[model samples]
Target: MLNVLSILIGLLSLVIVIPAQIPFLGIANWIALPFIVVGLVIGQLSSSNGGRNLCLVIFAVAVVRLMLGGGVI
Candidate 1:
């Protein structure tokens, strides 16, 4: 379910964050953002703290990317 997707997108985010400046791939993070948000919402719907925590970590990484001016530019 969403827990699995959250984990997958979370890992994907790590890779995307690094190569986000590669022109065509620069939109990768932006694309993943929706998936990440979906995962977060779905994770919250579940009762497991682990799922929510993983989503949060993904969110944190997204935030860090923004703070570092890593958004699509």
Candidate 2:
């Protein structure tokens, strides 16, 4: 159950991240970070690592984007 919830949250953050990929929209990723963190925490509580791994990947993408944008675009 927790894993499922984490995945849902990760997907939600992914939605935000997709749009944030647009130039000058990178700030949206900052907004999505909290959601991603929440998902990670929830995922950590579950027995399976799938959701946790998903969140980690999403987190990495967001962070890399942020770096490319120099924190803001």
Candidate 3:
């Protein structure tokens, strides 16, 4: 159950992240970061690592995007 919740959160964050990939919309990643973190925490509570891993990957993408935008774009 926790894993499912985490994956759902990851997907929701991914929705925000997809739009944030656009040049001027990187700030959306900032918004999504909290959601990603929440997912990560929840994922950690579950027996399986799949949800945790998914959240980690999404977190990496968002961080890289923020870096490329110099924190804001």
All candidates' TM-scores?
Answer: 0.62, 0.97, 0.98
Which is better, 1 or 2, measured by lDDT?
2
Candidate maximizing TM-score: 3
* Model 2 lDDT tens row, 1-73: 9999999999999999999999999999999999999999999999998899999999999999999999987
Residue-wise lDDT of candidate 1 within 1-73, one digit each (tens)?
A: 6576666665665566557645445566676677667777877776665666776776676666655555644
- Estimate every model's Cα lDDT from 0 to 1: 0.64, 0.96, 0.96
Model 3 spans with C-alpha error above 4 angstroms: none
TM-score of candidate 3 relative to the true fold: 0.98
**Alpha-carbon RMSD of each model:** 3.3, 0.5, 0.4
Candidate 1 residue pairs in clash (backbone atoms < 3 Å): none
Q: Rank the candidates by lDDT, best first.
A: 3, 2, 1
Lowest summed lDDT window (length 10), candidate 1: 20-29
lDDT of 1 at 31: 65
As for TM-score, the candidate ahead, 1 or 2, is 2
